[model samples]
Target: MTKHIIETVTFRLKDGVKPADFAKSATAMNAYVSGCTGFIARRLSYNADGLWIEHIEWQDMDAAKAAAAGIGAPEGNRPFLSAIDGPTVTMTHTELEVSVN
Candidate 1:
């Protein structure tokens, strides 16, 4: 069954780097993630901890993994990676118990 995957990526901006300089690349990455086949929905957010959390919904776990493998540099994620001090990416699968919509 289709499920939601919350992929959180933490980016510690370089000593003199600002999130603004990397916004475009982040946006591009998100656009690619949201446009992939089997993508149902997505949301990206920033936290005071200096990490970006991207929640993505895919048709299934297999689809999610396939899409994630494609989420690296080839998709233009190189800039984002270069602009960060330290970054970590992880994905979590969520089972919905109930939904109003």
Candidate 2:
């Protein structure tokens, strides 16, 4: 079986950026991502302490990598990227293990 890939991004919003504004960006980003090949699911979450995390699931590593390489090319993603505190952004990709499910 082909294991899926999960792309995790954790970051902080730029100073003065509201959560609602960030949410709007996330919505736009999801719209663009959903149209990509192998996109499975996407979820964005936050906490009381002001941290944001986005999880995106793909069919495999290649699909995840392909989407990431061109993520900055879309205007829809521009707001989302711009709203983030660049230095605080961290990302990871992990293969899904069925045994853990």
Candidate 3:
């Protein structure tokens, strides 16, 4: 059976970065990821506490891992990575074992 992979990342923006700029950067990153093999979907959201969250879905863990290896290399991803406060970043990936709906 094929396993689904979900990658979640929580982060805060660096000082001096604006939300509008970050949004544009994220859009670029989204486009880049969309072309990757096995990419399913992606969502960007924020909380009232100033944390930004990114949820990405992949066909499987291998695809997710492959994409991760190039996260810092693509030009389109630079803005998104540079805008993030590195120290505040937290990321995790999991395989879907159960689902209801």
The prediction achieving the highest TM-score against the true structure is 2
lDDT, candidates in the order shown: 0.66, 0.91, 0.90
Report the alpha-carbon TM-score of model 1 versus the true structure: 0.69
lDDT of 3 at 29: 90
Ranking 1 against 2 by TM-score, winner: 2
Q: Lowest-lDDT window of 10 residues in candidate 2?
A: 92-101
In model 1, which residue pairs have backbone atoms overlapping below 3 Å?
A: none
Provide the lDDT at 57 for model 2. Answer: 90
lDDT tens digits by residue: candidate 3, 1-101: 98899899999999999888899999989877998899998989998777999989999988999999988888879989999999999999988777654
Residues 9-100 of candidate 1: C-alpha lDDT, one tens digit per residue: 44466667676777777776776777687787766667776776666767777777888778674647788767766535454676544545
Per-residue lDDT for 1-101 in model 2, tens only?
A: 88999999999999999999889888988878998899998989999988899889999999999999999999879999999999999999998775332
- Ranking of predictions according to TM-score: 2, 3, 1
The true-structure Cα RMSD of candidate 3 reads 1.6
TM-score between candidate 2 and the true structure: 0.93
